[model samples]
Target: MGLGWIRRRTGHRAAKNQPGDLDMEALIPDHFLCPISLDLMKDPVTLSSGITYDRQSIDTWLEGGNFTCPVTNQVLRSFDQIPNHSLRKMIQEWCTENKRYGIERVPTPRVPVMPNEVSEILFSLAGSARNLDHQGCFECVRRIKNWAAESERNKRCILENGAASVLSAAFDSFAGDCGKKNAIVCEELLSALSWMLPAFDEESHKYLGSKASLHCMVWFLKETDDLSVKQNSLLALKQLLSCDDHTKHAEALAEIGGVNDILFKLIREKISPAITKASLMVVFYLISSSSSAGEKIKLSFLEMGLVSVLLEMLVDSERGVSERALAVIDSLCDCDEGREKAYADALTIPVLVKKILRISEMATEHSISAIWKLCKCASRQEERVLVEALQVGTFQKLLLVLQVRCGDDHTKEKTNELLKLLNPYRAGLECIESVDFKSIRRSF
Candidate 1:
C-alpha cells in the first residue's frame, strides 16, 4: 500500500513539473506575434527605434521617422537595447539544433520560460557547484568516470540521456572555491568528448534520434572562458575529426573560430596568459582536425594575425599550448594555399626552420611532428635550412626520438625520404653509424 501510494505521488509530481510538449506556445504572445495570422515566427522583422518586436506591423511602419510601438505605440529609437526573452530561447534552440541535426523547428526547453527564468536557472544551478562537499565531489566524478569506462551502453546512456544533469553536476563542482579544476571539469570535459566521437561506421544520435549534447557544450563555453572549458573545447574538436559528418564537424569548427574573438575580447581590457595560451591551443587543434574547413576560418585567422598569434604561443611556458600551436601551423600549411605562400612570400620559412630546429633540440615531440609536417610543404630555401640544421646536430635528437615512439620502419623511411628531399647534397649521407642503420633499412 505504501509503495503504490509513493509511486503514484512521484508520477503525479513528475507530470506536474514538466509541462506538455505543446505548452511552449503559451510563452509567446498574441499582440506581440507576427502580423501574419497563422504561423510561428520565421523571420521576425524589426522596428527603427532598434526595437526588435515580434508579431507587430514592422513593414508598414518602417516608412516614417515617427515610429510607435506595435503593441502600445511607444516611441522607438534604439535597436541595441531591445530585449526579447522568447526570441532568445527560440534562437538558442535554433542554433543548438542546427548544430546537431540539419535545420529544424527550434526547441524550447519548457516553452515560454522568460529570459530571466533561464538566467535564474543557470545562475542558481551554477552556484550549486560551489557547495559540492569535497568527498562528494570526488566520488561523483569517480562514478561518472567508471561508468564511462565500463560499457558502451552505459557510457552512451549517461552521456546522451543525462548529459544535462551531468553538466549541471559538473558546473556545481566547477566553482573555483573547490580547487579541483583539472579533474572536476577540465579533464572530464576532455574525456567526455570521446563519447561524442562518431565511430567509423556510426553517426551519433540521441534517444530521440537527435542530439542535444551540443547545447550542453555551448553552455559551458559561454558560461566560462576558463582554461578547463577551453581545453575541453579543444579536446572535443580533436575527437570530432573522427566523425564522418563533415557538416557536424564544420559546425563544431565554428565554435573554435569564435575563440579568436574570445581571446581578443580579453586582450582589449587586460591580457591573460592562461587564456592566451588556451586560445592558441584551441586554434591549433581546430585547424588541424578540420583541415577542409578553409573558407570558414580564413577571415578570423587573418583578422586576428592567426599565424603570428600561433608563433607567439611557442614562447608560452605552458608546453601544451605551444604544442597545439605547432599543430595549427601544420594544419594550416596543409589546407590554406595562402598560408603556404605566406610562409614563402612573406619570408617566414627561415623563422619556421629556426623554431623547428629549436624544438627538435628541446626534444618536444609534438613540436617535432608539427615541424616535420610543415617541412613537407616548404620551399627549397626552407628545406636548405632544415637540412643544414639537421647536419649541425638536429638529426641525432630526431633519430633518438625516432627510436622512441614514431620509430617504426615506415616513419623512419619517410623521415629519410624527407631528408633527401631537403638536401640532395652529400651532407645527407648517413656517415655516422652503429645504431643498426642497415638493420633498420633492411626492415624497411
Candidate 2:
C-alpha cells in the first residue's frame, strides 16, 4: 500500500510533468526481467523449461557451449528458442505507459532463423551450383550473406547447416570463368565465406584444399583490385594452408606462377595491418611446409627482394607485423643466397640488433637466429659483421638473453655461441672501429 500510494502520486505528477521528472527505480516488476541478465527483456524468448529470457542472453548461453537452462539446470532437448510475443508486448506497453519516466519502447523483434531455413538456403545454393546457374546462385548466396551478417545465431545456423561446402563449390564453378558476371558472383561468395573463416571442419577443408580452389584463391589475390576481396581471399588461403594436408596444398601453391611476387607486393603496399599480417602468414606457411616446396618458395621469395621488404616491415611499431617479418627473415636466412642477400642490405645487421630483446620472446629469438646465420656464414666479411654486432649492442643483448633464458634450448645455445664469437672482439673494439663497416661489403 505504501509503495503503491507513492507510485500513484509520482505517476500522476510525471504525467503532468516532463520526462525524467519522476524516478522509476523500484517501479519495474520482477517478471519483466530476464532470468539470466536480470534486465528488462526486449526480445523475450521462452525456453523448453517454460522460463522466459532475453533472446540475446539465451543465445549467449547456448553459444558458450552450455546445454541446460540457466535457472532450472535441466538439459535442453533442443536449442530452439520460442519467442515470447506476449511478454515482449507487455514490456513494450509498459514502456509506452511510462514514457514520462524516460522509458523507451522496444521495437518488434525479427523472427529468429531456424536450422531448417538455413538448410533450405543451402539446398537452393547447391542446386544453383550444380546447374552452373550464375544468376540463381548469386541470388541464393546474397541471401545467405545477408543472413550471416544479421546475427551470430544466424551465422552459427548457416555454418552448422553446411554453408561452407556449398559456397566452395559455387566459388570453384564461378572461378572457372573469370568474366564480369562470374567475377561479381565470386566476389560475393568470398565476402560471405569471410564470416566463417578459420572455423571450417575437415569436410569443408577438403573442398577448399583442391587444386582448382587453390588456383582460384591465387587468382583473386593476383587479379582483384578490390581491397576487401583480396583480404578475404588471403583469409581463405590462410585457413586452407592450416589444414591437415597443408604441405600438399603448399606444394600446389608454390607451383602457381607469380604467387610469391603477389604476396610480396601485398606486404610492401602496407594496405592494412590485417591484410599485411595474413599475407605474411601465407608466405610463412608456403615456405615452411615441406622441405622441397619450402626451399623452392623461399628461393623465389628471396629473388623478389624479400629482404628489403621484410626490413621495411621490421621497423613498424606494430608488434604483430614486426614479429612475423622477423620470423620470415629467419626462415629466409636458412639458405646461402638468403644470407647473402641479408648481408648485402645495409639495414639488416642494425635492424636485427635493435629488435633483439626488445619486441617479444619469439621476436628476440628470430632476431638472434638471423644474426647467428649472418655472422656464422660470413666468409669474407666475417670480422666486419662481428664488429657490427658488437657495435650495435648485440653482445650485451645476447648476454642478457642467456641470463633470462628468453627462448628454447636451441636459441640459448645459439646465443651462447654468438656470445663466444663476439666476446673476442670486445677488447679489439678500438682497432675494429677504425674500419668503415658500411663500406665493407661482401661480393655476392
Query: Can you tell me which runs of candidate 2 are displaced by over 4 Å?
Result: 1-26, 63-67, 74-79, 97-104, 179-181, 402-405, 408-410, 428-444
Model 2 pairs in collision: none
| lDDT minimum window of 10 residues, candidate 2 | 1-10
- Cα distance off (Å), candidate 2, residue 135: 1.7
Tens digit of per-residue lDDT, candidate 1, span 94-185? 44543222224543322222334334433443344456444454444455556556544345445444344444344324523323343344
Q: Please, what is the whole-model Cα lDDT of each candidate in the order they appear?
A: 0.44, 0.81
The prediction achieving the highest TM-score against the true structure is 2
lDDT score, candidate 1: 0.44
Please, what are the lDDT tens digits per residue for candidate 2 over residues 216-330? 7888888888889889989998888877878877887888888888899999898899999999989988887765988888888888999998997787658899888998899
In model 1, the runs with Cα more than 4 Å from the true position are 1-247, 252-260, 263-281, 289-295, 298-303, 336-376, 379-410, 425-444
